[model samples]
Target: MNIWESHRFGKRIHLTYHALRRMEERRISLDMVQDLIEKGTLIHKDEKYCWIFKSYSHRDDNLVCAAVIRGSAVVIKTLMTHWQEQPE
Candidate 1:
């Protein structure tokens, strides 16, 4: 897990290592994800199961993230159906 900071409205946010890598590889910002999370625009999985991470970008590039589910976290490139199997 990466360092997380809670926003004023109680949203957990941080620069994912993957996001940082993306920044280094290309150039993206976690700001979009942060904004969506803050505004509650991004609804990932329910709190009972999974929590989704968000990333923002000026370029039309795929956003990736890492998440801890069950007891492990892995890097993910897409959230489309069946993509969870890659992490599995």
Candidate 2:
């Protein structure tokens, strides 16, 4: 696992063993997760990329990937909605 110097949630970010297991299953890279946690906006809920100095991503080379860094192994909690249900 690649360890990155990243900042996490303002307070405590709780994660679960099951979440970690899910991440592993999704094949989401740790570096990508680090980019999420270290950078992105929390409340904005924007996709494409993380928020490092108000950065919004325009790159689409990688779409099916999502990540978050920091927290106690449980950094992400996603509920795939209708949009995600559609075929690209």
Candidate 3:
């Protein structure tokens, strides 16, 4: 399998330091993010990254994240607890 596909199947995933900080600040648990990587949809993909999102509606907002998967790692580039617009 390809690296990204391997990651989706629970291969070793290393988060960047920035990603770790962002997850903590956003109160996003590692398990939550991991689940997204494993089961989230690939919303967008560029030459260097793949964006995966797992969205859930809570109250009037959406709890979601746009993760940038590069190589064998998933980096949480943007996370929103009450997202309004579709993640890019």
The whole-model lDDT of each prediction reads 0.38, 0.38, 0.58
Return the candidate ranking by TM-score, descending. Answer: 3, 2, 1
Predicted model with the maximum TM-score: 3
- TM-scores of the candidates are 0.36, 0.37, 0.62
Weakest 10 consecutive residues of candidate 3 by summed lDDT: 1-10
Q: Is candidate 2 or candidate 3 better by lDDT?
A: 3
RMSD of 3: 5.1
Cα-based lDDT at residue 22, candidate 1: 51
1-88: candidate 1 lDDT, tens digit per residue: 3334545334344454555565455543445444433443233454433434444444454333333231132222322211122332
Model 1 lowest lDDT segment of ten: 76-85
Candidate 2 stretches greater than 4 Å from native = 1-15, 44-88
